[model samples]
Target: MWDTVLIVDWSGGNDRGASPKKDAIWTGVARAGQAEDPVYHRNRQLAEAWIIQFLTDEHAAGRRVLAGFDFAFGYPAGFGRVLTGSDDPFAIWDWFAAHVQDSPKANNRFDLAGQINARFPGIGPFWGNGLARDIPDLPRKGLARHGHGIAEKRAAEQQAKGAFAVWQLSGAGAVGSQVIMGLPVLARLRQRFGADLAVWPFEPLTPPIALVEVWPSLIAKTIAATCPPGAIKDAHQVRVLAQAISALAPEDLARMLDAPGGTAEGAILGLGHVALLEQAARAPVLRNDCFALPQGVHWTPVDQALAHLRQHLPPVAGVQPQPLAAAAGQYLAQDVTALRAHPPSPNAAVDGYGFAGPAGTGAQRLTLVQGRSAAGQPYDGTIRAGQAIRILTGADLPDGVDTVVMQEDVQATDTAITFQGPLKRGANARAAGEDMAAGQIIARQGRRLTPADLGMCAAAGIGQLLVYRPLRVGILSTGDELRDPGSTIAQGQIFDANRPMLAALVHQWGHQAVDLGRAPDNRSILRGMLDQAAATCDVILTSGGASAGDEDHMSALLAGTGSLALWRVAMKPGRPLAMGLWGGRPVLGLPGNPVAAMVCALVFAHPALALMAGGDWPEPQGFTLPAAFAKTKKAGRREYLRARIRDGKAEVFASEGSGRVSGLAWAEGLVMLPDAAMTITPGDPVTYLPFGSFR
Candidate 1:
């Protein structure tokens, strides 16, 4: 993934004479998750120098840079071989570097085209010049232009609509001059970067500086919608494109930079013929790994599996603004900075008498003022040296007030109050901005806001918050021997317990659960159910039929159609875990047994759902307590024992089998054991995870 993105609109014309007009040289720079306005340059030389410096600084800071230039990087097939005797595109770049005579505002691009045409027979391919005088062998129009033993359009240009051929030099949408001038800049950048630069569609993208060709016309609608009125289109194109690409999720950006389309003729970064680039910039949840474990891996550790999920999973929720009252329990889409400070001024911390006192004075009796200072009312005049005013709690401390004595400590008479000794200076006095400050980020992006967080936001003068919509998780139960809770169970069938429990869990986690009811073990029924779930839900949760067996139709159908990954975790009571994508929606398959299903949901699915719901990855907090009973255990994997706190010590259930559905109801928490063989004695420390923490 790139840490910085630089998009440039190259110009072939001479200096536009300062004052920042359109169609000169515009470069947009996006870094650190923010994009700035495009910088304008009057000439190509100044733009080239500025870009080189920007790239150099970014590389020096150890940031990967992706540079996109809006021009054709290469000619059609066989053109490079005809010009440089090789099919490699770099060979043509070398030729252009050696022959092109470029200055600050003038270049020999037209003369070079005429000279190149002299080598061919009849009228040459490069045509349509704006020269004041006619040049030999170069035609003024394309009617006499020859094919020159090569195709007229590159493969990428053929796919892109309104893409003018590189041969046209003096017409609307002409790119021939731009290609001539831009390639030399690329050549110099490569020379300067040496081993650190990579030109895409020509080589692999393992270097720090990735140079790719871009056509902004592919997303013309997006640019038109985002660009401001009366602004230059060239500058807006580069600026908006940089911001949109920079906002893409990391995995999608890498896919867009897939290289080596062809060495002779380059391809645009995105296909340019399809809406894939537009969708990628607007919505980026399409680049998940289906939670598939790495190749050659099986029975992954729980911690490692969690880490993989955190790395690959993306936020799939849409964003919007809501009032703070309705925004509770939603994930914040942006940072909320304080507009004004809470406790806006200095005030009294408690009810007391206020009067200015001398630095080293002993006890003194003062006259009580006529009026009292309440919460919203203040005394008009400052307290004199011999007079004190009664100040209530939360009342603003008036001017010339240094210290306040508690009313309980002062001996009050009908007209005067007496204090024993000089109190500490500024005692019981609150300073300005004691609670909050302006410009302070009270809440960060991707944070799950609580009731207290809403209160803090309200105190800081924030009325509305931009938040992500709640994730819709579908609860699907698929099993042959499953029945509804109220239905009579047959000899081989049992009532379904996991569906209601999981739906409740989803509700507790601040997500909506779309109950998909139940599907039989038949593949056709399960496939139809999954398809429907994918259409309406952000994530799907399957109860049973997840194993690699004939009756496990969920796994069978997923493997056949979309993608399947059976993640057998190295933990007890919860191992039969499956994750996949059906119709582009994430699906998590849990074990059939009630105990194991609940455990897996808490230990694995909880955090994953939080991430997909656009909140930060939640790591459940656990505390340690002494074990109430002693036991010997050997382990190659971690284990969670259903336990509860008894007599201030952790106690495990009598049975450790997953078939004991009552154990899930009886226990209040789970005790986590590490993957190491050890004997537990009485009073040994054990880690306990509460059920409430999972929420």
Candidate 2:
């Protein structure tokens, strides 16, 4: 799908009649339409003209033209080699060199191989025998010294507008060249252009007359001989090769196409087509389907389950605890009625207070008479002329007393207090209904009891609270081989860990866990226990007896009861889990394995209990983590893996097996590998459902 090409000279020109001669001219070309086919020519002038015309025409058409030529854009010494046979082959090289070097009008130029090697004297061809030999680094160098002559030429042609894609083939001539040269170019291109670019390469070689008939055979043989054994046979080898070629400049393509030994442009095009096909194959596909319920089964989603339980569960009817205590500071309220502030009348807060005065005379002083009120009790008598009441904080003022003078501002004599400061009528007094009026609703139903609520109710004179009863959950383990802890463990018997685990889990949800004890493997015994549990408990939870074995009586009993909602879910480990109602009570039957039982209980039991308690279900939350190792799983089954986060990434604890308790023990949380994921690799992001996400 890419529209540009840059061809460079690495094996030299094909003008010397397919001889062993190394004479080659690195040419740059950009074309929108096909050019005239090449004819046998001794002079390299035609080849040069074809390149210049292709580039000029493509540029004129407003298409992005990528020109690939031979030369290390950085160090000249690392440029690709040009084959030559003459005594002074440098002359032909100098002539071709003059074209690119002297053409100042050329724009957006890029050199592919050894064309720029003159700038770095010590560097050599990367793929030749001595590719690894190091060279001295250049200093204070600009574009000319960097050997980006072709790129400079192309830029001049572009008039300095858009960016250029330059491919620097690092490894090409010798052993290990495929990877060494390909990886660097691919990595840089991906970094610059993202992963969407298409790369194609052509290998060209002019064959000698003696080898012309066997040239095709020789090309394959030489490739096989030069590549390591088994390299060509590797499944990923082609992919790697394509990725490498994708990084080369177009000039490299032209130079290789002009090689003396072989040329197959069609094979290069095919490789490119295959690469595109592979990318398409990697795209994801989706399918749409609804969750199915088993025949005659009445399963409901969690939200519906909650609503059903709430509607069917019987409400508790009983006397509730009184809101307040009786002793001093112990009981703030004594009855069901709201609280009332003291002083059925008006009151004063200061001392040396209160007497009634005429309506017009403002300055008034009254005699200190009776000490009347406190916070809880009100003053009863009235105040006469020139008489005032001595009041304390929150004390009620007597009738006919409208004002009071501060004790500090009154001069006290034997039987009377004289006022030094003038007093205004009704000063320093408290009025009725100032703090609270009666009959306001201070507390409501279904509200969590907080200290503020309690205080507000107390202030409003509420003495008792009407709170709902806590849900009671029954926990039963249904395995015959199970035994409670603190008892002697006989051979072939395991401790009843599930019972305590389930009980503690229920308690954690703010519900009472009614231990129904472990039931034997007999159907009648299990039925009787479940019946009794359903009679009193809001929900009944049992572990084991839900699998396909003959001893798995839970599913059978549930089916017989005609109230079983769902027998099996489309999930792993917990697939045998059964959700149903027994004797009008909700029942959750979990798998026998400890981990499976625990996980299912967290996922389903917690929500069911919260529903029974008249609460809403919460959604599960998880984080993203990179998979620690590659994994392959069944295509249509969602698998939950108990894993731990390591180095800020997810790592499965161990291979998941329903019977493996050690795996659960080592896990920090669960990793939800979806059903659609067929395989996972390191660094692949996966949903890390932490243990906290469950409960």
lDDT of each residue in 405-436, candidate 1, tens digit only: 88988888768988787577788888778788
| Cα-based lDDT at residue 315, candidate 2 | 24
List TM-score per model, in order. Answer: 0.61, 0.38
**Residue 26 CA error for candidate 1 (Å)?**
19
Taken over the whole model, the C-alpha lDDT of each candidate is 0.82, 0.49
Once fitted onto the true fold, the runs of candidate 1 whose alpha carbons sit more than 4 angstroms away are 1-286, 357-361, 384-387, 413-416
RMSD of each: 16.7, 30.7
Candidate 1 — number of clashing residue pairs?
Answer: 0
Residue 234, candidate 2: Cα error in Å is 85
- Using lDDT as the measure, the top candidate is 1
Indicate which candidate wins on TM-score. Answer: 1
